[model samples]
Target: MFDQLIAYLDSVRARDPAPRSRWEILLYPGVWALGFHRLAHWLFDGELYFLARFVNHLSRWLTAIDIHPGAKIGRNLFIDHGFTVIGETAEIGDNVTIYQCVTLGGTNPTNGVGGKRHPTLKDNVIIGSGAQIIGPIVVGERARVGANAVVTDDVPEGATMIGLKARSTLVPAETWLREFIPYGTPCDEPCEQGNGGVERVEALERELAELRAEVAALKEERQVPARSRKTGAAS
Candidate 1:
């Protein structure tokens, strides 16, 4: 158990640079939260729903992070900082790094039946702060979700997702091969101005040009009619 704890702390240290020592990492709210979650999940598995819920609420109160007792989390699932929420049916894989203010939220089924409604994060996935991953989507292995992205669809392996609607950005092989990326964003490239943004900008520009041409033609038509009426009146 001590060896496992050391390994977990080392994993967190690899992802985070702020921690000076394993002792410091141990004091982190994410670490404490994960510990409480383990107890809660154990209780939940034994059908002690009330005790599980009690532990979950206590963890939330202490750590400011809410992870449902029913959520299945794998080893070294690091939650950097706090204010993160994992839904009941959410499944997190090994070495998945989630930043502050992120949500692995579930979709509301119209039939109102309880099932797998939350997201599943594959191994080595990194989620940035304030990102919302909704629905029962699969975030593929080694995928990176940028800060403030809203994802509702399945992310492909090794892809980098960005923007409000969360469009995939092509990442260079060198960047993708890196061990870890801070904030799940590539510093070498502009994430917000991706291919999708460029295409949308071009489309909007084309539409604006077409509208301008139509407006000019209408003005010309009105001017011609007014000139003809003036000429007839003068004659």
Candidate 2:
């Protein structure tokens, strides 16, 4: 029992809002996170929905962290510093990484008595900053949600999503950073479309390839042409 407490404390210190020494993290984070989750879970289980919401709201206001009471989060889930939110009825697997301003909410703003309403995040999922994952969708294991992405559909295992509307990108699963707290970076070459440079690059490559083929055909035509022998003139 004592050993578990010590370990939980260590994890908290390491992943809490404040950056502390190794020893400080080893002792603080566990206690804070545990306390927060316990209250949240307790309120969720209770029938007092209004009071539960009120408590959750107060907690978020005071801590800049908001988790709906009905959300089911597994053990050792680290909440890194930033604006964090969890939707009611959201089911999170163990060992998830959530950065600031991330939402795990349902699309239905009005409450319903349905089971498949909120997002279900599988184990080891990494959610980036300012990302909005709304609706009833499942984010598969080890899936990575990129910064400022608005996701509404289901994500497959090891998938990486990016952009406003949220499209899967070529970023590999291994390269995903667990704690991705994004800040605004000026775009050196923002695309005409919202997909940064991906769409533009593809278009340019296609055009260049066509141009090269056309040039080669023109050169071949200029070089050697069949002349009609009967015409007695270069055709």
Candidate 3:
């Protein structure tokens, strides 16, 4: 427990810009949430379900973060800000960072039987603020989910997931880690640009329009046939 607490503090200090003092880390909601989570998880595993849920409720009330005791989280998990929701069956790996208003929610509402409804975040995954990862998707290691992105499918390892459909920016995980970008922005690309398929279709349509205009101009500027010119001259 002491080792895990140290790792957690280290992660928070590394990521956040404020509160440089060790004492200040106590005030961080991320710390409180995870600290309580440890106890809650312990109780849950011991079959003390009621006590686990009660602890979870208390943590939520104090931290404004909702993490089900059933969610298995690893060391050095940093939940930046409050208002984060981690559902039951959501498994989080080590060194994962999640910003405020992020939801690891279920895609299927009617499936109340509750299998693995929430998503799994692999090690070193960073989910930006306001991002929603739905269903039992696996967010691969070192993947970045952009702010406001709605991810309904699995994300490839080392990819940057962005846009409404969660298209990858193709920036590798190493590059993303090296450069800390806000709002999960691409290291050097615009966020709102169309995806590969959309861009390809747009480019093809532009080229086709240009080709059609060229064909029409060539037909209009074509010279009269030699035979027709001679016949007209004879007439």
Cα RMSD of all models vs. native, in order, equals 7.4, 8.5, 7.6
lDDT of 2 at 52: 76
Model 2 residue pairs with clashes: 8-30, 9-26, 10-26, 12-29, 12-30, 13-25, 13-29, 83-101
Error of 2 at 114 (Å): 5.0
Instruction: Estimate TM-scores for all models.
Output: 0.80, 0.64, 0.75
The order of the candidates by lDDT, greatest first, is 1, 3, 2
List clashing residue pairs in candidate 3.
Answer: none
Q: Which stretches of candidate 3 lie over 4 Å from their true place?
A: 1-3, 109-112, 172-174, 177-183, 187-235
lDDT of 1: 0.96
How does residue 47 of candidate 2 score in lDDT? 76
Candidate 2: regions farther than 4 A off: 9-34, 109-114, 172-235
Q: What is the C-alpha lDDT profile of model 3 across 98-213, one tens digit per residue?
A: 99999999766685676878999998888999999999999999788999999998999878888897898876555666644554556464445658668867999999999999
Model with the higher lDDT, candidate 1 or 2: 1
Supply candidate 2's per-residue lDDT for 51. Answer: 77
Per TM-score, the best of the predicted structures is 1
Better of 1 and 2 by TM-score: 1
Clashes of each: 0, 8, 0
- The residue-by-residue lDDT of candidate 2 on 109-150, one tens digit each, is 466666667899998777878888998899998787887888
Give the lDDT of residue 192 in candidate 1.
61
